[model samples]
Target: MKLISWNVNGLRACVNKGFNEYFAEEDADIFCLQETKLQEGQISLDHGEKYRQYWNYAVKKGYSGTAVFTKKEPLSVSIGIEGVEETEGRVITLEYEGFYLVNAYSPNARRDLSRLAYRLEWEDRFRAHLKRLDKQKPVVICGDLNVAHQEIDLKNPKSNNGNSGFTLEERGKMTELLASGFIDSFRHLHPDTKDVYSWWSYMPKVRERNVGWRIDYFLVSERLAPAIADARIECAVMGSDHCPVVLELNGF
Candidate 1:
């Protein structure tokens, strides 16, 4: 099975930039999106009429949200963490016979770090949620995690060290999550891969220079690692500041 995750930045804006064209070309069995930035009824997406589309929209209009488009219908769908009081529409859980797919748009620690505390708190809750799901079945977690977990994940680690996405605290939280039994599929496939990133700054020539951060990911439970046939970043595709990250699993 092939799955693709992308932080479209804004789904409506991305659609105008040929989102459907690229989506068709990829032909993912399950396609997930983050940062959709729109509420229900604002935009209609026609993914060839074959996909079973599921969306989670925030109460606030034109803000954080997520969506999933899968060719195979899920056995069940969940909006957010079961016990957590959330309203940003940051997550969608789709349960299949084989695994649970958790599509998440992690809260971004703002540029000023004002949201850092909330971001960290959310991380703990999110990790706990995944662990609970893993107890039932393997979980495929994908989206813009909003943090660059390692020094090699960004263009200039030295200069970006203390930034919101590259902060020590944020990185540590990612480490904790991985240690808790999830594997970062991309890194597992390409251990030493460097300079390849999923997200780029919108500044002039930044994308051309490939100055970017690997914030988006396709992570699976540790036991599912052997099934990861391919994990890659589609850097050449362009629509949003972020590109698509893909994971192909065998015999799933």
Candidate 2:
């Protein structure tokens, strides 16, 4: 099966940038979207009419949100991790026969780190949630995790040290997650791969220089690692500041 995740930034705006065409071209069996930045009744997609669409919109307009488009129907679905109280609409989970697919958009710590406390709290709850799901079945977690895990994940680790996504605290949370029986699919495939990134700044020269971060991911439960045939970053595809991350599994 093929699963793809992307932080569209804003579904409405991306649609104008040929998002529909891009969506169809990828032809993912399941497409998970983060940072939708829209509420109910705001956007609709018809790229694949056979796919079932599920959305979790925040109470606030034009803000954080997530959605999932899947070719297979899930046994059940959920909104967010328990006790997190995510009014920003940060997560969505679909329970299939053999696995749970979670789409998430981890909160940014802000340039000043004002939201760091909340982000930490989120990490704990989020990890717990995934662990619980993993106990039931293998899990496929995807979307923008909002952190550049290691030096290889971004272009300039030395210069970007202590930045919101690269801060020690944030990187530690990621380590905690992977230690808790999850695997970072892309890193597993290309451990020494460099310069491959999923998110870039809006600055004119940043994207061109390929100065970006690998904040987005397609992480799966450790037990399912053998099924991960390939993982890729679609750096050439562009609409938002972020690009889509793809994971191909051995069996759908």
Q: What lDDT is reached at residue 151 by model 1?
A: 85
Clashing residue pairs found in predicted model 1: none
**Model 1 stretches with alpha carbons more than 4 Å out:** none
lDDT value, residue 174 of candidate 2 = 99
Off by over 4 Å in 2: none
Please give, for residues 1-252, the per-residue lDDT of candidate 1 as tens digits: 999999998999999998999999889999999999998888988767789999998888889899999999899999998666769999999999999999999998999999999999999999999999999999999999999999889999999988999999999999999999999999998999999999999899999999999999999999999999999999999999999999999978
Candidate 2 lDDT score at position 188: 94
Give the per-residue lDDT digits (tens) of candidate 2, residues 7-99: 999999998997899989888899999989998888777755679999999889899899999998899999988998869899999999989
Judged by whole-model lDDT over C-alpha atoms, candidate 1 comes out at 0.94
TM-score, per-candidate, Cα-based: 0.98, 0.98
